[model samples]
Target: MKSLNSDAFRMSIAWSRIFPHGRKEKGVSQAGVQFYHDLIDELLRNGIIPFVTVFHWDTPQALEDEYGGFLSERIVKDFREYAEFVFEEYGGKVKNWVTLNEPWVFAHAGYDVGKKAPGRCSSYVDKECPDGRSGYEAYLVSHNLLNAHAEAYEALKKCEKCIGSKVGIAHSPAWFEPHDFKDAADGASVDRALDFMMGWHLETTMKGDYPAIMKEIVGPRLPQFTQKQKEKLKNSADFVGINYYSSVFSNHVEKPDPSKPMFKQDSLITWEGKNVDDISIGSQPVTAALPVYARGFRKLLKHIKDKYNNPEIMIMENGYGEHFGNKDSVAVGTADHNRKYYLQRHLLAMHEAICIDKVNVTGYFVWSLLDNFEWQNGYKHRFGLYYIDFNDNLKRHEKESGKYYKEFLSQGVRPSAIKRDEL
Candidate 1:
């Protein structure tokens, strides 16, 4: 953090560390709580503001074993209790808190695709995960997750230590454009994609219900909120944190056979990087990379402003990912020219949104500070400002992108510092 010259830092707490057995009755770890307090103190000592995420997809294994983790409504109360504990512990020091990080991704990837931890999906979706009902479980888990967030938000408001703290959910949403802007169905597909991906949570948080199109399409498969739960969910967040990396073109899809329901097919849309004419949306920087579409960042900001009542927004996670090859050396890896280019473009797009478009964006935090273990992709995917030498006692080395960010954060954008070829 001191090396990056970053003004703020964001970190997540592992629920298992705090409550090993996933409930207060099982026993709370004072050491775990103290560890965060010490870390927060060190950050403040170095003049870095701390933004803490109470939960970040790592539910306690004990919880998963107890009631199938987020699949059951019983997990909501457990999550609320855990969140309240954190609020009472660090709320006075940490004014900014994220109740949950990317619940949509968690629900979808874990239940729908069966790729993440405690993976579960219908046999038709992934034979390995034979326990889940793709569309049904995803919605059920999401419903529970939202209610848990509302409970946590209410708890934070009641906590005396958290008097002025602001709590929000971190949503990972990508911008979607029509594959053919002239095609009305494709344009409508964009809206449907957004509703399923983003509005599923944002609309519920803002309007106390799911999107109308979602209800109409998903029907009984989609979970419904009770009157009391709806009231609690409405205005449950102080702000919305969007974690954007790239955008894709959406094309309309015919409804799937009713007998075979999957969350991916429920939206009735397909995403692509290029249009039917084979024209790329933006430059592709890495292998298997989603095109680096910075314009989408600005477009997404304006969309949120116009559609979600212009709430205070924060760029929670935006960074470029690089695939490290076996032959790559530390010196070669640390140069990170591609990451520098990605950061430069996206930051510029964000500036345009804030200064030119007047999107009430409050802060921006890069996806990572260190090249840690990436879920599913594991260590193969690198998205860090500081390169981690995994083979050598996990030593940290600053990438060129880190240096660029240090300068950008300290001196603002210096066009002269960057070579034209870099962009």
Candidate 2:
């Protein structure tokens, strides 16, 4: 990363890695603790800021077996203990802390939709899932996750070594546009979609509760925060961390089937890559699930700025993913002009958000630095500036996108000097 003139690296610490079980009382791994110590020291030595995530959806199996993990309130106490342990251990070295990474994804995917680890969903939604309530479990898990974050934040405040540290949750919310701009309902769906997607967790940290729309729609399914929990949750984040990938067109669902209740249907909207006119959102990349729409990126920033009083923000993760089969050679992987274009356009959008809109964005980090084992996709999808040869002892090869980023950073161009159309 230093070679690419990158100054910061965002990484997550697995809860299982630190505590083999769930709690520190069970057993703490000295090797695991030392591993992070060495890694943090090396990053510091290279003058790179380390933004460490406390938890990244990896709940220790012991906790799951004991109390169903985040589905139960018991996990909150354990999470707080784990967070406190880390805060005391490396709090002095790591100033930027992410309490949780994409809690929305974790709860929705793992508990509601059953796409990721510890997959649990209603049998009707996914027969493969062992057992879970489609709409109910996600809300319960997210409720606990919010409380866990509040507890972690409180723990951080008490840690003397972490006095100067900044902590927040990394929220991955896709930008949404109305499928039919002419339809008022479609436009209303966009706001409802954002409320369900981003505001569920975000508004909790800001206002100490979920969006009022969610409370009314989800009703009994959505968990309510206690008066004490509300106080702890309000203003928990020092900064907002956003992991944006793509934007989608949101069409209003006139009436969802009451029989099949799920989190997605709860919002009464359907997300699409094409508008009502069948026009694509923007340019859809071959490997990307959603189309590239940089305009949505700027709009999303402005939305957050206007709604949240322009709090400090960080682009935690943004990049292009490509599907490369075994037959694809290194030459094809190295020539990633599409990825470069994606980066260029998004960066320009972010620049517009900062300069013209005056959004208080502090830093930006790409999705990845090297080809990694993406969860669920495994190694099939690569989203990295540097290509990895899994066949040849994991050899590293820099792609065109890497060169573009390196040059982009080396220039150190001021925002005022950038021409709007040049990018």
Candidate 3:
């Protein structure tokens, strides 16, 4: 971060590392506690602020073994303890805290799709999944995660040392555009899609309950927060952290069969990478993320501003992921023209949201500093500004994009100020 002229850095601590058995009763690791303090001290010494994410989907194995993680309400109490422990420990040094990073991703990918840790999904969704209630578990997990986040926020607010700290959950929401701009059904689907993805949590946090559309669609499958829980959730965050990557087209589904249940199907919206004419919505081909769609980003920001009474926001994670496969040439990696283009475009879009749209965006952080292990994708997809040589003792080399970021950070250059062709 110091080398890149960055002002703040974001990181997460492994839950099991702090409480080896995932509970304070098991015993706390003084060494594990000290490690983060040392790291925070180092970041502060280098003139960089720290944004600590309390939970980044690394639920302790023991917790999962004792009881299904997040699926059971029991996990909520443990999560609160874990969250409070960290807030109390580092409250004096770390002023910015994220209760959880992408609770939606954790719930859906982990419980619905069975692609992530503690993976579980209905046999119909992923035949290999050992066991899960696809539609039911995801909602249960999300409900617990939200409560955990709310409790954590309350804990931080009460802590004298952390009184002034800004705490929020980092939500990952993709911008969903209508497949056909003139199609009313498609346009409504776009709103439905947002309600399913972003509003599932955002609305709960902002309005003290879930979106009305979600309640009508998901119905009994959706979990309800108690009146007390609702009070805790409303205005839980001092600010909102959005981790946006790509945009997808939402087309209305004429009829969705409720007999065969799945969390995704409840939306009654099909998220398509390409529009009705099968055209890419961005500058590049559709891949893990829809190609760079800067305008979609602006739209998303504006929507948040208008719909959620825009508190404050930070672009927590935004970057492009390229699957280089087995290709391992430093010369090939360092060039990274596409990655640089991705950064420039997204940053420019965010700038427009901040300056022209008058959205209260406080900061932007690129997806990563180094190409590391991505969940399920593993290291196949590289999203980092810096390239890592996995086979060669994990040596790090700055890509062209990294150099460009350093210049942009140091010179206070808006991404729009530089011509794309100049790079």
Candidate 4:
């Protein structure tokens, strides 16, 4: 494998690395800033573009303790100040900016039915509030997230002559399918499925607010947005970065109970010869690792194009890997053949969006360059093309999949880069 390159390769700046405690008074670490300055140069020197995301959910522990982080509106200004600082100092070196990476996942995973960071909302009713996370607070958090993003977008737009590009957010969309194809109840479940996963984010970023169905169904439980805020929320993103993983099935069920919290998920699966419920309430099992629905990738792209007026879109996070022993390849490493084909197929879909659908698809970045500390899963599920040997030795061996990616780039078909192999 040879020559691998791209106009842009994104890298993250861990929040804790700088603030350590997530506080403004702690002072922005020059070391963190310098690391990226050096990284941006390294990419440039190799003829690769540098795309940077200021916040990727590594909230300073300091912020979390003060008032539950994003749970409170206090994070808006704090986040803005941090973003402003980065734009002012590094705008000269970097062009592309992502304000928040998957605010939905951050909110859902971090709160509500807590699995990620800073943990739960605790109270049941507030979980239904706009600021609530989990499935309920999707509105409050998303509303604030959008305003924060817009404020940052506005700030970045003002300095466009300096930054020289647009600012956006990356959202992971979980595709949904009806549980019972012939049952009307199952079809209704798919709507609820969309509401919980994909619809929640799309409404805010694209339509400029949460879905109307939230109010129609949840009634007063939905968060309130002012007229001015509504305007600001609309058209906030200069581009949309979508992370497509897998699809699920949605089945309608009784309204989510405030007391007996259950995590019901619409799954494209079954048990004992019965199709799994299209929608579940609170605590539901993730039957399969990730629903193997590749076609949903194309439908979502088309949906984005038609629904969002073809806003500049990029597949920011889309890569697959295996965890259990070795699947097809066992060259003493990870990187399953399914992952290689998954990436290649998605990239082709992206090309279709560009060639036929006439979507303003910008660029695509695989989920990770290597298998690293995957939050809760903790390196259990490897999603990297390059298998990371985090065993006693942190050796990174380019797997067959990595070799395939390198070949794709070597064909002179991708953005230019000095291949690590060639180097």
Best by TM-score: 2
Please give the distance, in angstroms, between residue 150's alpha carbon in candidate 2 and its true position after superposition.
0.2
Least lDDT summed over 10 consecutive residues: which range in candidate 2? 414-423
lDDT of 1 at 354: 80
Ordered by lDDT, highest first, the candidates read 2, 1, 3, 4
Which residues of candidate 2, in runs, are more than 4 Å off?
1-6, 413-423
Candidate 4, residues 243-341, lDDT tens digits: the string is 787765555565445553322322121211224543431111232246455556766787777766767787778876456644423364553666665
All models: lDDT?
Answer: 0.86, 0.89, 0.85, 0.65
> Per-residue lDDT for 1-423 in model 2, tens only?
321234888988888999999888889999999999999999999888899999998899999999899999999999999999999999999999999899999989998889998899999899999898899999999999999999999999999998899999999998888899999999989889999999999989999999999999999989888999999999999999999988899999998987888998999998887898999887876656457877888899999999989999998888888885655668988898988888888888888898899998888999889989888989878889999988899999999999988888777744445456644
Off by over 4 Å in 4: 1-6, 21-23, 121-139, 160-163, 188-192, 254-288, 325-335, 412-423
* TM-score of each predicted structure versus truth: 0.95, 0.96, 0.96, 0.83
The candidate, 1 or 3, that scores higher on lDDT is 1
Q: For residue 244, what is the lDDT in candidate 2?
A: 90
Model 3 per-residue lDDT tens digits across residues 24-53: 999999999999999999999988899999
Q: Per-residue lDDT for 251 in model 3?
A: 82
Give lDDT tens digits, candidate 1, residues 1-423: 221235888899889889989999999999998999999999899888898999999889988887798999999999999999988888889999998898889999998889987688888888888688888989999999999999998999999988999889889888998898898999888878988999988888888899999999999988889999999999999999889988988988866777778776889987787997888877786542457888899899999998888899988899888785775568867988888888888877776788788899888898788888889989877888999998899999999999988887777664444443543
Listing every candidate in turn, what is its Cα RMSD in Å to the true structure after a full C-alpha superposition? 2.3, 2.0, 2.2, 6.5
